[model samples]
Target chain A: DVKVTQSSRYLVKRTGEKVFLECVQDMDHENMFWYRQDPGLGLRLIYFSYDVKMKEKGDIPEGYSVSREKKERFSLILESASTNQTSMYLCASRSGQVRGNYGYTFGSGTRLTVV
Target chain B: AQTVTQSQPEMSVQEAETVTLSCTYDTSENNYYLFWYKQPPSRQMILVIRQEAYKQQNATENRFSVNFQKAAKSFSLKISDSQLGDTAMYFCAFMKHEGKGTYKYIFGTGTRLKVLA
Candidate 1:
């Protein structure tokens, strides 16, 4: 079966430390996304990539950056981790279903804690 | 911009019973998609069901179905014969059909559903 996998299921980082959350999908999907889910705020998008070496900012991109050097792997980098960034970070990928409709397969989320 | 809303933050249902989770959205775009995703205690996001805006017929997937009222801008999920595994946080989402090749998933806060045995 096709899968979206996260390198880590949980992580704890110190404040001011750089953190990396990695996600890889085997479906060869063209779209990959990173979102941070918080209570009451829902899943806010941090960044997304539709092609390798290409990326775009989403609704919430502050304190975060992304790299898509390869098609299967998408990495989220927290340059300087802060307590406010502690939350469940989810990664998802979707292939082209059709012209107008698409669905996503999400990886098991990584719950990040910044102390 | 698209916005999704799940007014009910929490809900409960007895085993083997049926329950519906409510979702509403606001968007100017006439075409779009709506989805119901379940996040279990394991924190794995699973797609429960989906609805296409242009389709008048509500979608059904096994015991999980949807009540899609396009004119009402409401998409609710109904789980029949609720099972213990059905208990999770249900999220509603919206993605507008902008032809500019912009694809984004906008999500609702979520509804926590508990299935009691």
Candidate 2:
């Protein structure tokens, strides 16, 4: 089965701290995405990478940055963690229409808390 | 920009019954894709069903099916014989077809569904 693995399931960070959320996919999918899920706000895209070393900003990209050093890994960085930035972070990966279906395979998600 | 809307914030249905979740989207593009995703308490979002804009027939998967009205830009999901396991948050997503390339999905706020025994 294809799998998307998040490095941490839960994390607590202090204000002004730099937090990193790591995600790795074994499917070798070319497209990887980062989204923050909040109650009543659903999921908002933060950043996505379609190829190695290439990234694009999504709907909500403020206070966030991404790295795609390899095809299998995508990293989301919080430059300065704030209390309001705390939320559930999800990582997803998809292949480029190998079978005409572009469904996303998502990780279990990382719940981060900023204090 | 494409936007998805799920007006029903919370819904409840008895087991063995059917429940429908409403989703509407706004897009001027002639070709696009709509999807329904289920996220249980575990928070693992999974694709339940997908509908292509060009297909006139609605997509179905087992007891899960979609009502795709391209003219109205509405895609609703219907769960037949609702089970306790069906309780979860459902999100409606929209993605425009861009050649063979993949586009980002715009998701709605989601609706919480509860199945009662």
Candidate 3:
């Protein structure tokens, strides 16, 4: 079965620390995304990459950045971790081809805690 | 701008009973996609069902079905014969394709459903 694997299931970071959340997909999907899931806000997109070395800022990309050096790997970076940045981080991948299963395949998710 | 709304924050149903989760969206685009995702206590979100905007028929998957009213911009999920394992957070989502391989995905706040035994 195809899968999107998130490197860490949980992480704790100190304020001002640089944090990295890694996601790797074996499905060879062309589109990868990072989202922050909070209590009241379902899932807010942080960044998405449609191709290697390409990225676009989503609705909530204020304190985050992303890198897609290869087709199967996408990483989210927290420039300066803050308490407010603590939330469940999700990684998803999708096929660029429009013919089948257009819905995203999500990873297990990482719950990040910024202290 | 596109937005999805799940007015019901929490719902409950007895085992073997039926329940429905409500979802509404606002959009001007004629063609798009709608989806219902389930996130269990394990925290892994999975696709429960999907509906194509142009199709008049609602989508169904086993015991999970959808009530898609395109004119009303509403999409609701119905769980039949609710099972204890069905307890999870359900999210309604809207997807709009913007050409050049760019797409916008928006999700509702989500409804937490509990199936009592």
- Of the candidates shown, which would achieve the greatest DockQ relative to the real structure? 3
For model 3, residues A1-115, the per-residue Cα lDDT tens digits are 9999999999999999999999999988999999999998899999999989999999999999999999999999999999999999999999988684689999999999999
What DockQ score does model 2 reach against the true complex? 0.89
How would the docking of model 1 be graded?
high
Every model's DockQ: 0.89, 0.89, 0.92
Residue pairs with colliding backbones in model 1 are none
Cα lDDT tens digits, model 1, A36-94, are 99999999999999889989999889999999999999999999999999999999998
- For all predicted structures, in order, the TM-scores are 0.97, 0.97, 0.98
Docking class of 3: high
Misplaced by over 4 Å in model 3 are none
Query: lDDT tens string, model 2, B35-104?
Result: 9999999989999999989999999999999999998989999999999999999999998765546465
lDDT of 1 by residue, B1-112 (tens): 5789999999999999999999999988777889999999998898888888888999999999999988889999999999999989999999875555666679999999
Fnat per model, in the order given? Answer: 0.82, 0.82, 0.85
